[model samples]
Target chain A: MSTALAPARTGSDERLTGFAGEPLDQRRYRRMRFIRRFEETLLQLFEEGALNGTTHACIGQEADAVAVIEHLAEGDHIFSNHRCHGHYLAHSGDALGLLAEIMGKEAGVCRGMGGSQHICAPGFKSNGVQGGIVPNAAGIALANQLSGNDAVSVVFIGDGTLGEGVVYETLNMAALWKLPLLVVCEDNRWAQSTPIAANLAGDMAARFAAFGVPVREVDSTDVEELSAIAGEEVGLVRAGAGPRVLLIHTYRLCHHSKSDDERPEREIADRWLVEPLLVHGQRLDEADRRRIDDEVETALGEVVATARALP
Target chain B: MIFAKELGDTLRGALTDDPRVVLLGEDIADPYGGAFKVTRGLSTAFPQRVRTTPISEGAIAGVSAGLALAGYRPIAEVMFGDFLTLMFDQVVNHIAKYQAMYAGQATCPVVVRAATGGHRGYGPTHSQSLEKHFLGVPHLRVVAASLFHDPREVFSDFLGRDEPVLYVEHKLLYPQHLTLPVNGRIGDLLATSEGGPLPTVRLSAVPVEDCTVSVLAYGYQAMLAAKVIERLAMEEEIFAELLVPAQIAPMDWAPVERSVAVTGRLVTVEEGADGWSWGTEAASVISRRLFGRLRRPVDVVASEATVIPSSKTKEASILVGSAQIEAAIRAAAR
Candidate 1:
């Protein structure tokens, strides 16, 4: 029931300390770190040309995926956009299938037909499409409404996706029908090298609020904070409070994809401002941070070894 | 008897029978009912299951696909077949490719119902038999019901299957009623007659059992072919069996091949423009496989290769009818 927007604490160390005091378990932190490492390895693979097609690594924006996924039940659904590796991993999608999909192998989630752009997990009934999954998530939420179930549908979109007409259309319908849906905009300053100022005009949170839907903004780097806010909002939706929007402020650390090499100073400055992993890691003590880093490296190393072993 | 009313009753019965079934479309509710009245009284009968949606065709199809993925058998209506173009992406890319693209991991068991064909004078925008647009999708089923009984039956079958279905209904034939034989139950239609007991019929010098002419006629065209056969019976003593293919894509070819074997000739009749239509594809398939059994070349009776004319006289002239089918049948017979 708390509608108070937590003020953005300055300094990575202070933010991390604040998050550590919150209720995130070590296992969840380890998982978030594992996603960051896995994404870093994926970027390396893409650099070596081992993986085909475009890869949108959620390198810096790990907290958004981790936090939002923590609020979802196993039966609830997650509809992800193209930049979905973190979301997919956080939602319990298979690592081997994710790697195989990136490699365009038959073992991939989409059977190599969709490459990394459209991987889906049948078990969870959760899937990822480029920009097409925006309206699709609303449709799924509508289904949950018709079924009269408390299952909440979450749609993860980047700042760039707000430009799409379908996304707004979906948001309007979700609000109009008072459907149980959570629209999480991972506002990672840059949408494929384009800054939010250059692309999006006007305030994003206010845009949804104007449509009569409650809107909230949070720091995407703090997993514990993000999880708390997301969990409360999801609960409200389940209680028939209608659709809500969470504009999570995050950063995309890497270049848009392997193809883009434009690492301008402005981009680097923007990345440093909201470096999600660095900011989240800085909060823990030196020993705890080192332990988390080692665990993440080992886990990612096993995944890389397994992916390489595939024939 | 399985008349149009019975068809609606059967659909209502099936909806009430299954918890997974849900219906959505324009004017599908009670009072005004559907435009064709096929879903009459369904909304009130099953208030929770049957829903009337806004006139957003793309959203209708997309929602159905999503619901199907979420384990619901959603039967969505597009009001008219011509409006299907608006949801082409949802139907062809999303619903059709779900199973194939996902490597059989997921299935979309959604059924899309649309009233197709000309004769309502709704002109080009409203009237079109465009099921051919969905012909070769890997994991989709295209079922057109010419008779009233088959709609409920085919719909029930589609609900049980794990593939998406484009269930096309002809607007012109909705009023043309056909009576079910005595002792025939609604359950009989629900059963997929795949490779069932073959009908014994005499064909040109040979006593054929199960032949496949791929007599690819759907909706009103199928009824027209049957009428043509009736007229042929009166004019000549020749008994040319008509194969009305209720299921087109992922076609149940066993019955069709059985019908074609004895006849050794394939004749297709369709109301759509001839080029690349279902009739054309059926002709090609028959000619290729049944070439050895065939005594003569395959013949196709379809509408002229032009847009549907607006004038009644021009429309009648351009549209292929029983006479053309009769001529085609005779040509293939010889």
Candidate 2:
């Protein structure tokens, strides 16, 4: 019985000020921080036996969702993979619905049927299986193209998704048909318990380039830089420039899922230095960062409280 | 009308009527048409709506699902029914689950048309009655093209549905003319097509109540059973009722139950492999429905479990034909 407050100020509103006169960067940071806290809360819920089934959290990868989703227009479509909470929250700002869905409440986004991975909302969708939804995303792109709509389709995949054959199949069709598809590969360098080295072979960018789709590769945790790059890529796709691939080399700061981290502690400790929150928070005023953190925690508190109260 | 042409006309009509209706397949465009020629003249008729895809069955079905999710009714053709194995994950995991998984918020009105059954020595890969594998999948309708039914109506009806449909087309039936019932009679057999949406065509040499065995079949096998029923009546003097259901999955057992109540015996024949098939499920259901009323236990006639060979004689020996249907019907009578 919870009512949504307002659409998250994540979109490029161009008002220069966001959410009570704060800068857009602060809003971006707040969104990312909210997603981070949201995922962290899910882990705590799992420990408390409040949730059943498994959830793939985008704990360290929140910036990818916040950075890329800002460029999408109203009619544009987004297809996300298993690790989708960050993308879903950034795209629809429906944390209460998502939490309710994962909690198996009837008030959930999909009426508690889709749960975490198989969520479907207006202009947004996510499936748990790797690479299976790629062709679907291409199809949506084709639909937009055929209808003469300028809306672009964006699909997010992990480094492990490259191992699926359907990804290549969709890439070939998307490139040949000149569909407006932006494939955002969030290369977190790991697929569950297995490292990318053991799973993926050959070059990631070359795999996309070989399909004749344009590729843009960047390794950064700073949301501002990623946002700028994503804006350019998304604009190119919207202009009917065929499919574009933005391969963001990022890291998974949390376990693949609940209580399943086999990664060495030292490797994880080093990644903490370049984590998106720390890198982005460095540029914001100390008082402003604290205020944003406090606001995110307060909002997430209501989302969780309302979700728990739902039938 | 020719079966394939009627289907083509139906596609043309759907494309013309709704801009959201589209066709995607391999070699389905102007020059090559399709593998079975069912999509012939479609690409030329509706240039933007019809598209030829690469040799990717998974993508063809998956993309069609995507189009359907986006409010377009897309009909994707998987060159041959055997290639549906490649599309299993997409159809079963994604397309079929989308509606229920998303709690009815999204509807995938996609039609996947594939040419199935083997008569022209298509061997293992090209010829397969794989419809049984797709049965019992939630939110998916398995409808077959039969000579007794108008395929134009079938395709049009499939386009009208809010659920996904696997439109099964027998390869051999594509070239044959559709033979509708003449005043409810096909020669000596009385013919009637019943059920709503996709239909179940009933044929009997005698009054359905007086028949000794109720024969069940679908697609090309059903058409063959109709011919076999006529011969069985004229030659052997054994009366049997044949039920040809176009919609196999989510089967409407009303007609089947009505026929079996009086007939007391049932025989199911299909072109797919013997066990774990359409025949098996029908037998299981019919037996449970009529436990003591049946005169004899239900029987099944189907292809052998071996991979279909390329040689003409070898393939003929493996697939179900009129002989198998006649023998199964004769056996059921005793």
Best by DockQ: 2
- Per-residue C-alpha lDDT of model 2 across residues A1-311, encoded as one tens digit per residue: 11112235354221111365557778788888888898999999999999989999987788899888878777889999989999998887778889999999999999889898989998899998888899999989989989998998999999999999899988998888999999999999999999998998888899999988989999998898999899889989988899999999999989998889999999999999999999999889999899888877877888889889987
Chain B, TM-score, each prediction? 0.87, 0.98
Q: What lDDT tens digits, residue by residue, belong to model 1 across residues A268-289?
A: 7776775666666666677876
lDDT of 1 by residue, B171-252 (tens): 7767777522223221122112333222111112112332223244666776676566555545664456666556777666
lDDT of 2 by residue, B140-230 (tens): 9998888888876787788777899998998889888888778998767898878775778899888887798899888898889998989
Off by over 4 Å in 2: A1-21
DockQ of all predictions against the true structure, Cα-based: 0.37, 0.78
Best by lDDT: 2
Q: Which candidate number maximizes TM-score?
A: 2
Q: Model 1 TM-score? A: 0.85
RMSD of 1: 5.8
Supply the DockQ value of model 2.
0.78
